[model samples]
Target chain A: MTITLNNRIETFSPQEMSITQIMDEKSFHFKMLIVKLNGTLIPRESWPLTVVRDGDRLDIIHLVSGG
Target chain B: MTIIQNITSHLSVKKAGIAGAGGLGSNVAAALVRSGVGHLVIADYDIVTKPNLNRQFFFADQEGQSKVDALRENLLHINPKADVEAHFCKITALNAGSLFGSCDVVIEAFDCADEKKWFAEWMIAHYPAKPLIMGSGIAGYGSPETLRVQRSGNLYICGDQRETNEKLVPLLAPRVIMVAMMQADLALELLLQEKPL
Candidate 1:
């Protein structure tokens, strides 16, 4: 499946995946993230349940730590 | 409901809320005030310490002073006319509304990763229409180019987006101020309705 992730085209297998699964695949371990699926905000508890399909726009904005 | 005015005049009527006063909050406050933000409502419960002197805007003699009190004084030094509301308390979801609800923009500069995560979710949920600029990774002295800002809707997260918590990487002045200044610049841009830098 192909979708726009962070404004870039990303292709992966299985055609569909949850937010948690996609983040894991992308190695996005940042704790503070703004997860948006096609412009709708997704809460943390919903990550495992929110699924995205081909052509979906999933934006996971990472808030870096250290300060 | 809008008035046509110069940028400086516009900033003089705008307000910003900062949730931390250690490094990012302190420095961001300074930058904002210097840039002509009229009022700043800063809330933080920490006290200045010797270690904090490495990056925070506080001085060595102000080590024992409360972070909010010290920061308010320092911010005033930069812009005497700037109105500052300093709160010596930790910002939680319950108090965040009271603290930052009325401000034009809000800044999240907490020290811990856990707090940042929780606050990010909280701010996005509670203040969807308000601009919330948050810092994530402002540690270490090298890799200044690694720092960047990520925007999603009204939430702006600035930093390297990958550094370990400051407790692990050790926060330094240059990079810390870099992120803080960037966050402050974003606040200005947001307040002026300019494109995010």
Candidate 2:
């Protein structure tokens, strides 16, 4: 399956994967993250259950410190 | 109309709400007031510290003073006629909409990604009609060429879009102020859209 992560296309072995698997694969270990699937916000608690299919656009934004 | 009159007429009546009165917030607020923004609502719970003098709009004498108080005073000095409301408290999702509800525009100048995301989500959910200006990835003494403006619906974000933490690259005066000024300019542009003929 192919998916768009942060505007870049990537190929995945599985046809579909949970949001948690995607985050784990990408190593997005940041605590302060904003995850959106197809422009819809996916709450942190739902990441394990949320599924990402082919052609999905995932936006994982991290927050940094410094005013 | 004279240049002064034109500027005053266009901006003197617009209200701006700024979240986070640190480097970005304080600088943005000062620029808006100097540009003739009529009213400003600024919030921040922090007090001025020794390190803040490096880039913030503060003086040595302001050390230990509340950020909002010092910022309000400085803004008033720039435009004595401007109305400034200082909230010496941390802004959260619960109080953000109420605090800046009536302002023409809300500028998100938070330092933490969590806070920024919370406020951004809150604004989108509650005040969808209002425009929000935000900054991210503004760190180090990098080139100004990296900075750019991006738009998504009513959300206008200005920065390099590269998340550089303070550990890797320290936040200097030049880069921080550059993004702050970009945010201020974008706020002004949005305010001017509501100007009366």
Candidate 3:
């Protein structure tokens, strides 16, 4: 199967490539994911249900610890 | 302009919530309350230590008080009619939603970029309808006029951006107050629907 990461759709294994899957892959230990797919920000509660598709324009804005 | 008049006319109306109650947070709360924003829900789990006196606008009498309590007292002094709800706890994923749920907008006043990111991400994710306003990059004690506002749709970050490597004043007073005032202005504009530039 193939799915897009960011704006460039790339081929990937059959593993799910949705927001939840990407966070899991990124090993995002944070409690939330700030993702905007096609200009629509996916709610934190909805990230688990949001299914990433082919050519999905995604912007994953995460938190960092910098003063 | 007329926005100020409108605020006074609608004195019964509550504007929004503020996440931090430290340097920037306390100023924002004071401005809003003075402008008759009606209601404020301020959260901060820190206390006012001697080290905070240089930048934080605390009187000599408030030295040993909790940050939330001190700030609330200052705000009430500005507008005795204002309703203030103070929470003496650090804002985190667990309480951000419940604490910020009722307000139309939320301010991320923490200067630490990491804490801003955490609060911004949580607010955008959990409460997409509510706008998140924050400050950043005001390091190195720069000019007060350098402050500006940038917006990406509903998210707005207002502050001065300085190089990360620069060594700034150990405790810059002017720049901190400048950025804090700019943030308060932006917050009021958002609340009042004033003509924004």
Off by over 4 Å in 3: A1-67, B1-3, B163-169, B194-197
Backbone atom clashes (below 3 Å) for every candidate: 4, 1, 2
Superposition error at B158 for model 1 (Å): 0.7
TM-score for the first chain of model 1? 0.92
DockQ of each: 0.64, 0.37, 0.14
The DockQ-based CAPRI class assigned to model 3 is: incorrect
Interface RMSD of each: 1.9, 2.6, 5.6
The digit string of per-residue lDDT tens for model 3 on A1-67 reads 4554444556656544667787777565553235676668677778878887755656654332212
Each model's lDDT comes to 0.85, 0.86, 0.69
* Residue-wise C-alpha lDDT for candidate 3, range B65-129, written one tens digit per residue: 98888987888788777788889988888888788898877877875656776677677778877
How many angstroms is residue B48 displaced in model 3 relative to the true structure, after the best TM-score fit?
0.4
True contacts kept of 3: 0.19
lDDT of 1 by residue, A1-67 (tens): 8999987899998888999999999999865677888867888999999989999988887665556
Provide the lDDT at B174 for model 1: 95
Could you estimate the TM-score for every candidate? Answer: 0.90, 0.82, 0.72
Q: After superposition, how far is residue B27 of candidate 2 from its true place, in Å?
A: 0.3
| Candidate 2's DockQ | 0.37
